[model samples]
Target chain A: MDLRPLKVSEVNNYIKRLLLSDMVLSNISVEGEISNFKHHYSGHMYFNLKDEKGKIKAVMFKGDNEKINFKLDEGMKIVATGYISVYEREGEYQLYVKDIRSSGIGELYRAFEELKNKLEQEGLFSQDKKKQIPFMPRKIGVVTSSTGAAIRDIITIIKRRFPPCNILIYPTLVQGINAPEEICRGLEYLDSRDDIDLIITGRGGGSIEELFAFNDEKLARTISKLKTPIISAVGHETDFTIADFVADLRAPTPSAAAELAVPDVMYLLKELDNKYDELKSIINKKIKAYKLELENLDTKLNLYSPLNQLKDKKIEIDNFLRDLTYVMEKKLNEKKAEILELKGKLELLNPNIAIDKGYGIIIDNRGKLVKSIDSVKLGDEIGIILRDGKVLSRVENIDEGEKIDEFNL
Target chain B: MNLTYEEAILELEKILDELESDDCTLKESIEKFKRGVILYNHCKDLISKAEGEIKILLEDEENTKEETFSMEV
Candidate 1:
């Protein structure tokens, strides 16, 4: 009857003690389908064990889960042995699992785990050993049951995506006892041939026993040995078969396998069109560049031509010729005027021109023109020349007086 | 121009580079143009040509003749 207030952690601790003291609660077993499984990075596994009626939280430390031989998967039927305890921080009770065992249809899961671990150890699933899937596979070889929905789906998808790609369907038993051998044979046959570019082996969703063929040790080994890249698509996306790990690629389903194996023709066509356009455009650009260059060269050649310079020189000569003609004409006009003036002066000196105006000239007997009176003497003979005739005369009387005007004479 | 698709593309790129350079003469550009045309035609031919129809193997035996498969599985 201690009704005093207690902290949340103290209450949680009290419940934890009560649960641990109970003999049955400390050592308990739980069987349910696993849900929300998470193997934390810190090496602790957290999950929920749920049945149709109820569910419980469970955690298994990495140390204990490491001893677990089988792979834990969601929705797996497992019997977990653990003790119930209260986590003080959350104030919630949870199962601290010590170990887990498979139950019901777990035999097949155990076999799958065993083979996966063995093949993984043998390096069959190594990334370096994986072959690259061709981007454009020439021909694809498919091994699946002809009657199953898997083949139908693969064919439909491959055809829808790429029509030109070649597919060689190797219809074989995808299940039953003979399925493993037949699948191996189909794979081998495809591998031995040179025409086969890639291989896809798979089946539709089924039970563990029905899908057991894909988990066969021999089939996984054979898939690993294939030179051609293979894609495994057995069962649903949740089912991970041994062949899925061994194959070069693992598609979630059969339809996905076809999608991975062949490239879409539409996408390839688009890319090819782009490249083709680039080539044409580049060539056209080259042509345009050449044309521009030709025009430039042509212009340069024309500018360099001597005909243009010759024309310029011709105009220059024409100007010089015009100047020379003007100079000659000016000189001739000046000479003509000077000659006219000189003719006037010469006429003034000419006695004939004076006689033409009723003047006379005198010369001595020696035929010299007497310009001064000293050249003449009294009673000396002289000559007078007129425009019409010439006459002899005498200097009859010499007058010393200086006032002889024309009217007086 | 008689080379593979990849080689033809590479050659075409080289020709483009040559055309872009300043020192390439007119005569050299014409020659490169002709070569580029040939390479373009070769690439187009390679791209257009595709494989034949899909087929299914008849049996486990090896043979060239195969039945042309259809969409029906």
Candidate 2:
């Protein structure tokens, strides 16, 4: 017999090392109903799992519990997988859970599957049955809890994305036994309204059981019958509910639902600006082309404009009129000089001037001037006239003399 | 001004096509340009005229009334 008096710490340390080294205790699984469950503020879970035969203390750290998709309740039946170990300070052995799953969740999932298949077979999940979401919904009808993160996220995002979109919230319970019916009523109420353009029904992230309200069969049928388009956003990204399949569209998160419900006003504003720019550019381009055409027509018509030829003809006529006026004036001056010279010669040939210079004239008896001897062969009477007096005489001629003296009269 | 954005845009497109074609005379161009100005103004006005107010519906058995509403949640 070997007997050694050892300290409590030493003994507890030895037991801890021994249990950790054992293969069966190092890796094992335990199934039990949870009691006295305490999820600590530090994110560590402490609980007691018990059955009719035995009981054990259990703990799950924050990191491992975060991987779980559901919450741990007091009466929940769970299957925990991890190693058994002794704590040296407390001198107690406990189960440190690395992985855990609800034992009854399998049944819930089974029901989910059965409903999904039934709906799929009924054509509720068909692509052809879904309604089209409007490009710019004037009003969005929301079916969700009025005081929660889901509604807050949806409102913030929708307002940020599209300010012009009006939201009509139907404040309904998102979970529990009556939540599905309330959701149905909310959806129905919004659908009945004429002003509602689109409907968004959902809640924030939650466990699978909490999201089961969206999986109700009656809710799916109500959604499928609605004329207005619907979008379902339940739980987190991985969660897919029956409402998601039946609705016109499915979003992974509440914020995502807001994004899908309406178009971004900034982007639409840009598109509107683009359309305006397109109109301006198209019309401006057309106007420029027309301007170029006008220029071409102007050049073609330049050949027909008689402005230059008319100007040249006007100058030629002015020159002809000036030359005609000059020639006529020269001819008039020559005529005046010739008339003056003829007047001087006419004045020198006047017989009245000779009479005034003392020249006399004679006439024969028959009132003829007998200036030549042959003309006075038997002249009986003759008349002689002076400048101031006249005398009458008779003449007889017996011999004709050829000798004649020059006389100036 | 009473036309929708789509109709207004369609007519504006027609005006552009007419101006682009060589068949239009000077008189026709002047007329179409005037009409184009009107259509452009209509399209611009439609975007600005989108009633952007937010409202909530309060319903009773007999009547329903609308009130302006805003909330963080």
Candidate 3:
């Protein structure tokens, strides 16, 4: 046999080959509680497995971790099966975990529930902080796994219901260790944008363990504080998560969330049309009533006009008084003229005027007039009066008639 | 010949409150609606008349050299 010195790298490579080929040691199993676990960027997990007596250093490569059945956590008792391996640089042996399972309910679930309860008691899930979703959102924001089927279902449902509304999707991790932080960041991004009216956060159905990120307390509080209304559509309807309680609204599925965020365009159009018809009828009736009332007021106004009433009464009384005054004046003038005529006639036929004209009068013994000479000659006694004085005389009838004719000539 | 714009607006508010309360009878609603229509028309007419008067006032001001201050100012 030929013995030769080897380089440091060569010896380490040789030991790595030997470890890969050793089936018996690589497949061995150990059961213990986890301590001081760390996952490296090289896709390997490093930790210690401890029993009541002592602890052993362990390593689980990326491939072996894929085969693990349950999540590994500090203080969790797990049964791990893997190969025995040695790090050449450190000159230390470590158990590489190929398989892992929970010995009981495990510490991971307890830790998850503890954090969730703390957040719940803090009122992070209170409905008062939840915003109301717009009746008809003009823009909708979706936060979900970029490659998941949930996004596809939401898009399809929204398109079918309404075509005009804008839909914006923010890619996010829905599972794994970093999912919670990524989801919170995505929400902050959408909330900063003024155009987004509502947000839908969810994923397709999954087991409770797979959906653990949604139950994160930080993520739940971030959702509750979002200014934009958020609709949680996390697993199936049966699967409730902390996000569901904290979001503004909860939907059974991704499709249901889209429906709640927007109104049906056709339905809205029909409503507008109906309102237009109703408004038209109301205005028409108002106009007709207004016109009729105006006409009624016009009639009343004409009825109560002071000028017309005064004119009617004035004309009737004026004519009546005019005719009365004319009749009274005519009667008064006629009476006065008749009195003047009576006075003139009396003046013209006065007996005193005849006496002033020097006419003589003869009287008998009883003051009677005698005109015939025969009456005086018959016996007697006669009296005569002149203009100046009265005389009593007796004469023959023939002589008296001659003297009266001579005076007349 | 009815109420002014301010008076009509106040009445309209009353009627709207009554209608929203759901306590008014159908007959009462109809009567109120009729009165509301009259008031609304009166308000519209008053507004138009005011606009016309404003136009006339503006024309007169333009023809003259007087300056007037606006209430808003």
lDDT of each: 0.82, 0.82, 0.72
Lowest lDDT 10-residue stretch of candidate 3 chain A: A271-280
lDDT of 2 by residue, A1-409 (tens): 8888999999999999999999999999999999999999998899999998989999999877765645689988988989999977899999999877678688789989999999999999999999998766778998998777988888888888877667888877787657888889889989999989899999988778678889999999999999999999998899999999998999999999999987776776676566557656755666787789889999877756788667778899998889988899888888888888998898898756777897657777667766776666555667777788878766776457755454543
Best by TM-score: 2
lDDT per residue for candidate 3 within A1-409, as digits (tens), equals: 8889998877877887788689877688888999999888997898999999999999888866743434678998887777887787876677878667566444557866687788778987676777888765666778887567788787777766666556677777787667788789889978998988888999988766566778877898889779999999988878878788889889988878878876665665554444334434554555566679899999899878988789878998999899889999999999999999999999988756766788667777788887766556655778867767888876644454356556763
Which runs in model 1 stand beyond 4 Å of their true positions? Answer: A1-103, A207-209, A321-409, B1-51, B57-73
- Candidate 2 regions exceeding 4 Å error are A1-102, A311-409, B1-68
Model 3 local distance difference test score: 0.72
Model 1: per-residue Cα lDDT over B1-73, one tens digit each: 3576557767877776766574666677668777777776776675455654666667545564568766553
Candidate 2 vs candidate 3, DockQ winner: 2
Task: Tell me the chain A TM-score of model 2.
Answer: 0.55
Interface RMSD of each: 3.5, 3.5, 18.8
lDDT of 1 by residue, A287-340 (tens): 787789899999998888899789889999999999999999999999999999
